[model samples]
Target: MMSPIASLTLSISDNATPYYLQLREQILAAIREKRVSPEDKLPSSRSLANMLGVSRSVVTQTYDQLVAEGVLVSKPKRGIFIANTSLITMPLESLPEAKSAEPEKTVGYFDSSADHSVFPHKAWAASMRRAWLNPDPKILMGNYRLGFPQLKEQLAKFLYSLRGLECGAEQIIITAGNRDALQLLQHMLKKHVNQWYTENPTYPPINASLTGQLEHLDVQLGGALPPENTSPWAAVITPCRQYPLGISYSSQCREKWLQTLSEKQGFVIEDDYDNEFIFHGRPVTTLFQAAKHRVSAEERVFYVGSFSKTLFRGLRLSYVVVPKAFVKPVLESQKQLGQSASLPMQPALSDFMASGAFYRHLNKMRRHYRMKRDYLESLLNAHLSQWFEWEKPTAGMHILLRLKTPYADDPEISGFLKSYAMTQGLQLSLLEDHYVDPMLATKGIVLGFSNTSENDMECWVNVISQCLGCYFDG
Candidate 1:
């Protein structure tokens, strides 16, 4: 009267893994774990192959290897059975000790859960193929450490024209990404710079990067920069579109920062991320432009931007525009540190930029995101009106939602929000925890509307409303 127990075999995809090895491992684990007991009837190789979703040859080879190892026995007429070898699990204490005495270290921080499903794969693939077929072997096989010279030159002209800066090709240093540039720059200036300055609710990665050597100056909106006589060594600021808070520094603020840097004989590392994607009217003039017009060349102001946000994450291309004097040392240090970029990537990106395809793509995405941002603003305004408030972001992929009341701490709120959102097939980001200065963490969440579908957005907005209502009603 009982239903027959169905037999199942392991199956795997051709995701850059070997088939025979996979088959061998699966069969071995089954035998060793006593999942297949001695004298247990096994399916024929063909049947097993079909069940496991692999070729018969793979199964046959694995079984042959196991038989040779005496772990599996095959009969003339009957099917294969497990051998009588002992099954044991190894313990850590029984393992061989490491030869070198190395200290164990574990570092932890907020991990951004980037939504990769939204990547433009078709466009990226086309770009990759174009680069692969490029006739220039220098781009394909040359020392691309200093980066593609053409890309740097184009970037120099672009920055000069667009940002109203006096940057030249020699001053532009290509990097893997924003994080790489920041970390490398920090390393480069760690000894020379003794203090750091940023907005209180600044980007966590930059805040975290400045921990050891430099003292952090946390400034709120309309906050004044430290006096130059104070001798604060350097400042890393997001002048255009501040992270999380989404506030842009005013012209007065930019003047104060420049004046402070000039008097202190310090430097400013201006991050222009997401400036091009501004949803509002024309973006305000950047610190780079401000300083370029006001300060001398020896003042040491650096401008950094990343294409990772604009093009796609995998591009891993960002550039830093330094003063001409710092170029030789920066390039020399890059060479000594073996810090180079992907050869084909720079040329491919260069081709995309020169052909105007990059700008076209940017224009398309900007319009798409602007629409999404408007709709998202409408949804939030309509449903969770009483529970939270957020400043309309001028640019960037994320929108910061400031909770009106502390309905729950980060863990509780995040769990409740994530639970409800996941049930409704919606995703929301908890951005408050991105702060390293714990006191500066907002009672808020970050909504990434760029990656979600319009339908998903509507449904998620409703789900968020319901969730917030439930939390409040109780």
Candidate 2:
């Protein structure tokens, strides 16, 4: 789960005069626009105060003003509620139109939808200062064309401890981010490999880059088609957590992957994005675990990971741990393409990991996101149980909801749901939206809870639940 405030939402600029008044105004606007209608008790005073980094009195004063204005009402036992007043009944004429006539910019690339204001700037600033004050500039300046030696070494050790793997510094090839790794990997292997296999309901960017020839698989359901016969030259999979579907590939299924790859001459690209954020029971084993059991004649297994899911997206750092055989070609491709991440920042990243700051920060974020995940999960159980079937992911940032519908085609339903999600500030992918085949497109919407706050979660989920009413009974 992501801190709603950390998603770069609700900016507070220097020109935001009368801070408390600004916060109050924002709240009123949401209420006026029916974004938060009557009976919608805003986040608790303490929570909102913390969210805005203001004194409790400030919130109290604003609440008092709304109460006096008859826009909000407080009950004896039940906390504050939006008053069912004329203001609530009146149409948009009473309220001013949205601030700009210009349509709001779409949240596309570089638009994380993260509440970045919640970032621990003070702490990060301290880390940056510490790095600058240190005597060793080589860590910052020296170019390890083979990628940052220190970061790779630290990551290798960390992976060994965390995921039970044996990796050397030489096996790790650090790059700008996951996209960079994908592009580089494709460039390196495209000639040798023509087809790329992916889960039917996978991430969009992954499908987009593969020239739209994604292999659609129906997750880990007991009775389904095994991908072994596909004979894909290469496959990219999220074994730990399937995006949107929130399904984890079963141990048997993982073994099946290894078995299939052994029989065929292909490799599996294991994308362990958000691998450390597991919530239920012990974290699952990595695809690398299966890799150790069976080494194909072609050495068909490559491991990839990124830091964007755990830390902020701006980090723009990801790495691939390639098999020894592919190392030469991958490095050659990187050199030809100038595909290296921030050379200097690698040491800072290394220092962050070596000093245990990475783990420390991860533990803190895990705790925070766990709370958010749990809260959202509880809300879903309470209100959406009838409409959706979902399994809580053992790890990862988002969840998949299987919606029941009378429609025979899944892609149509997926598109319908996707349109609704986008309207309410949600950027979600439909289960079948990434499929190359229309038969694979009819599924459910993938909800990303990482970037939304607990306060907004309830409101948005309510809207979605209502929209799902048409299909809920089916």
Clashes of each: 0, 16
Which digits, one per residue and each the tens of the lDDT, describe model 2 over residues 282-388?
77677776676775723677888887776677566788988788899988897776534655456667777787777877777767667777777898898877756
Which regions in candidate 1 have their CA more than 4 angstroms from the true location?
A: 1-135, 140-142, 209-214, 223-232, 405-428
Displacement of residue 337 (Cα, Å) in model 2 is: 1.4
lDDT values, one for every candidate: 0.65, 0.66
Q: How far in Å is the alpha carbon of 267 misplaced in model 1?
A: 1.5
The digit string of per-residue lDDT tens for model 1 on 128-208 reads: 577667447665344555678888887877666555666678778888667767766766776667666665666667766
Question: Which pairs clash in the backbone of model 1?
Answer: none
lDDT of prediction 2: 0.66
User: TM-score of model 1 relative to the true fold?
Assistant: 0.69
lDDT score for residue 373 of model 2: 71
Q: Which ten residues in a row are the worst by lDDT in model 2? A: 1-10
> Lowest summed-lDDT stretch of 10 residues in model 1?
106-115
